[model samples]
Each structure stands twice: as C-alpha cells, then as structure tokens.
Target: MGKFIDLTAADGFVFPAYVAEPAGKPKAAVVVLQEIFGVNSHIQQVTDRFAAQGYLAVAPATFHRVKPGVDMGYDEAGMKEGIALKAAVNGLPAPGVLTDIQAAIDHAAKASGGKVGIIGFCWGGFLAWRAACLLKGLSAAVPYYGGGMTAPAEIALQPKCPVLAHFSDRDH
Candidate 1:
C-alpha cells in the first residue's frame, strides 16, 4: 500500500520516507510522523489508512540521522530502546529533526497540490505540535499522546495552524 521514497532537507541531508497514495485523486495531503521506534509497520499502516481516506500520506524517517532504518516492535525492550533513541536525538539540537519533517511536508504538498496536514504519535506527536508552530503551509495538525508537549515551554509556543491534540490520562 506504501512505498519508500527519499527526500532532501534544506541543508542537503537526504532521508527515506514512506508514501501511500490514494486510489483516485487525493482530497488533501498529510505528513505522518513516526513514533520513537521510527517508521515501523504501525506508522506505515497509519499512512496507508490516511491514503485509504483519500489523502496522500507520507511518513518520514525522523530517526535517520541517528540510526537509519530503525523498525522496532511494541515490547518493553522496544520501549526502552525507543526512549534511549529519543533522548539521544532530542539532545542534539532544534531544527535537526524539524528539517527532516519539513522535507516531508514539502513532499506532501508537491504530491497532492493542496493543503497539507500532520498527525503524529508519542515522540512524533511532539513533533506534530512543533511543526504546527514552526512549519509553514500547513492546514491543520493532530497530535496523539505527545508527552513532550506537556512541558510549559512547548505549550507556550503558538501554532500557526489549527491543532487538535489527544492525551490519555494514564499517559505520563
């Protein structure tokens, strides 16, 4: 349902992205950010689901800078590894991952020739919110259980586009 494609960032960094296209014409475009585990099967399935809903979806490999081609499961060990990777990547700097995400957004806009939106889970959720505040040409954003967004500083950032965020009470 989806295929891996490459995208280049503003600084010439190249990374792979999984793109799922709708059968007919796409009504809109969406940039699907991956969880801490990278662009794994679940993320691909989510992208495919968006495609099925008449949107061209693209999930960029945000972890490519630190560890390329990471695809882990939903086990305890996977969670631990994902946490470590997220910490390492987060410590680097701002705009590092954001640049990659921008590449995805640009690709989606080019592919669909219409408004682009974003949706993300966990670590990706934080990114989705950040993108809403920082990136341009976005129609809307949806973030699911973004733990980082709980920070006061993150919440202070204003979004340029409309955002709908989801949080679970049990999540920490």
Candidate 2:
C-alpha cells in the first residue's frame, strides 16, 4: 500500500519519504509528518490509513539530516533517545526541516491537483502547525498533540490554511 521515495528540498538536500497511494482516483493529498521517532512503521500505517481514505499520503523523514532511518519503539528508552534526537535536530538552523516538508507538500499538491492537507503527531504535530504557517499551497492542517507549539510567538505565525488541532488534556 506504501513505498519509500526520495524528495529534494529547496537546499538541494535529498531525503526519503514514505508514500501511500489511494486505490482509486485521489480526492486529495495529505502530507503526514512523523513523530520524533522518524518515518517508522506506525507512521507508515498512518500514511496507509490516509491512502485508504482516498487520499494520496506521504510521510517525509524529517530526521534525515541528523539521523537517517531512525525508527524506535514507544518504550522508555525509545522516548529518551527520541527526545535526545529531537533536541539535536532542534539545535540546527530554522526551517531546515521545513524545507523538506515543503518538498513533501509540493509533491502532495502535484499528486492531488492542488488540494493538499497535512497531519502530524507529537513533534510532527508542532511541525504541522509550523508548516501551515511557513509553507505555501496547503488547503488544511491537522496537528495532534503538538507539545511545543503553545508558545505565543510560535502561534502568532498564522497558518495559510485551515487548521484542526487535537490535544490531550494530560499533554503538556
């Protein structure tokens, strides 16, 4: 239902992305951002689910710059390692990953004929919001449990598209 593909960023950085195509003609395209764990099996499943819903889906490996092919479990050690990796990537320059995200969005728009949306979880959730604000040509955004997106300054970056955000009361 899905396969891995390559995408080039604005900076000419090439990275891998997981793509799931709908069985029939697509109604839209969705750019699925991954958690801090990278484009793992769970993310792939999500992409497949979106594809099953009649949308072309893609999930770019946002951690490629710092650590390529990162797929970890949801155990405590995985969380610690994922947090560390997230911190490491966070230390890099602004919008580096965003460029790759834009590449994904561009692919999605082309695939769906300009009707594109983005959805993400955890760290990817924050990125989904950021992508909404920073990237162009998005029709909508759905961010689930974006932990670090509560900052006023960050939220001030208005989205170019409609956003549907989901949060857990226990999430910080």
Candidate 3:
C-alpha cells in the first residue's frame, strides 16, 4: 500500500496526502495533483508510477479544504459531484487554491530531499500550470486535459519553469 501523510498548508489547515518513494536517491520530488475526484486510487496509482520512475511522489487532496475525505471514482455521478466541488473551490479568489498547491510542493520538497516538480490531471491539471507560475522552486510541470484553463489569462502565460500540457480535443 502507498504511504499516507497529513500535510498542513500555509494557513494552518491540514489535509491528507498520498506519498510514494523510490528505493534509491530521488531524481526529483513530484507533487501529483488529483483529478476532480480527490486523491483516490487512480491518483495514488499515478503517484506510485512517479516513484517507480525514480521520483519522490506526493498527491495532495486539494478539495480537502472545503470537504475532507472526498475520494470518488470515475463514474458519471462521481463526475457531477466532483465538478460541483471544483466549482465551489475554483470560484475562490486568487491565493486560495494557490495556497494549497504551494503547501503541497513545500511539503513534498521537505519529505523528498528538496527538488520538486508537479503534475496534474483534469481539474488538477489547471492547478499544476498555476502552481508552476506561483511556486518558486518547481523544476517542471505537466498538466493533462486541464479543463477551464483556456480562459484564465493570469495562468496562461509562460510558466516560470518548464511545463508540458496535454489537452484532448473533446475536453474543450
């Protein structure tokens, strides 16, 4: 089973995060941002994959701020619920979700011996891109099918570090 840890954000809020470590020295620390679903099995599997690739991996439950312990599957109903939760949190002003993302990156760095990267899926994908912009120590960022990122002018500029974004035509 993957390891679980409690991470405290900058604002003194606590959240659950899944972590996976490689056998040898890590090439870098990777913070895995979850899909609309919380840090569920799929996200954990992805974290494990990063660990297998020689990176220390951590996937933070971003929605833990609004509602803790919200892990959901990839079903239609799950999608609706996840979307609702996303809307509630995403609608917040600047420095809201960014606060959580920064905290995740810092926590992973401390746990993984410093160097850090980020990756995100679906809604988390947008967060990944934004994290690259907001966080200072990021080495790289990968965002996949990040919905609703196209219109955010502030987060649309070139990232502070290297970033690779994957988008599906059907998602937009």
Candidate 4:
C-alpha cells in the first residue's frame, strides 16, 4: 500500500519517505512520523493503515540526516542505538529534522489537496509536537508517548495547530 518517495527540504536536503495512498479520493492527508527506529517496517505498516482508512499517509525517514536506512528492532541494543541517533539529531543546528517533516507535510497537502495532520510515537512524537508548533500547513497533531515533550519549555511553546497527546501510564 506504500512506496518510497524523495522529498526535498527547504535546505535542499533530499530524503526518502514511505508513502501510502488510498484506493479512491482521500478525505485528507496524514503525516505519520516514525519512532526513534526510523521509518522501518512498523512505521510503513502504520502508513499503510492510514491509507487503508482513506488518508494519504507519509512517513519520513527522520534519521536520514544522521544515519540512513535505520531499521532497528525492539531490543536493548536497538534502544541504545536509537537513543544515540535521536541525541545526534537533537544536537544538530536549529530546525534540524523539523525541515524534513515540513517537506512531508507540504507534499501530503499538495498531493491530496486537503488539510494535513501529524501523528508520532516515542521520539517521533516529540518531533511531531515541535512540528505542530514550528511548521506550517498542519491542521492537527497527535503525539503518542512523546518523550521529552512535557518539559516546561516545550509545553510553553504555543502550537500553531490543535494537538492531541496520548501518554501511557507506564511509559519510561
């Protein structure tokens, strides 16, 4: 249900994204942000699910700038590696991975000709929250277990779009 496409950011950085299109006309578009493990199979499946539900879904490889083709499993080693990668992205200059998300949102809105929304998990959730606050062309945001997003600074930033945050009671 999905395929890879290259999107160029405002900084002329091109990255790959997993895109899933619905069978008929789409009601809207959704940007599915990947977890810390990058846009792996699970993320692609989520995008496909969104496409199945009549939305054009795009999951960008947010880790591409730091490490391309990351597809780590849910193991201790993977967690450590993913954490390191996320930290690297965090240490990047201002507007690091956010630009990639903006590119995906812009593509989704243009391709589907409708409003765009974002949803993410884990580290991606934090990025999604930032996108809602800093990016353009987003109508709504949903961050599931957004790590590091509850800080006072992050919470104080006004979001440009409405946001729905889902947190697990047992989250680390």
Better of 1 and 3 by lDDT: 1
Global CA lDDT computed for model 4: 0.93
TM-score of each: 0.97, 0.96, 0.92, 0.97
lDDT of 1: 0.92
- For 1-172, candidate 4 gives per-residue lDDT tens digits of 7999999999999999999999999999999998877788899999999999999999999999999889988788888999999999999998899989999999999999999999999888888899999999999999999988989999899999999999887554
Error of 2 at 14 (Å): 0.6
> In each prediction, how many residue pairs overlap at the backbone (N, C-alpha, C within less than 3 A)?
0, 0, 0, 0
Residues 115-141, candidate 3, lDDT per residue (tens digit)?
A: 898999888998898887777779899
For candidate 4, the C-alpha RMSD (Å) to the true structure equals: 1.0
Rank by TM-score (best first): 4, 1, 2, 3
Query: Which candidate gets the maximum TM-score versus the true structure?
Result: 4
Put down candidate 2 lDDT per residue, 21-126, tens digits, no spaces: 9999999999999987778899999999999999999999998988888998888887888899888878889877899999999998897785999999999999
| Candidate 1 residue-wise lDDT at 33 | 90
> Against the true structure, candidate 2 has what lDDT?
0.91
Collision count of model 4 = 0
TM-score for predicted model 3 compared with the true structure: 0.92
Screening candidate 1 with a backbone cut-off below 3 angstroms (N, C-alpha, C), the clashing residue pairs are none
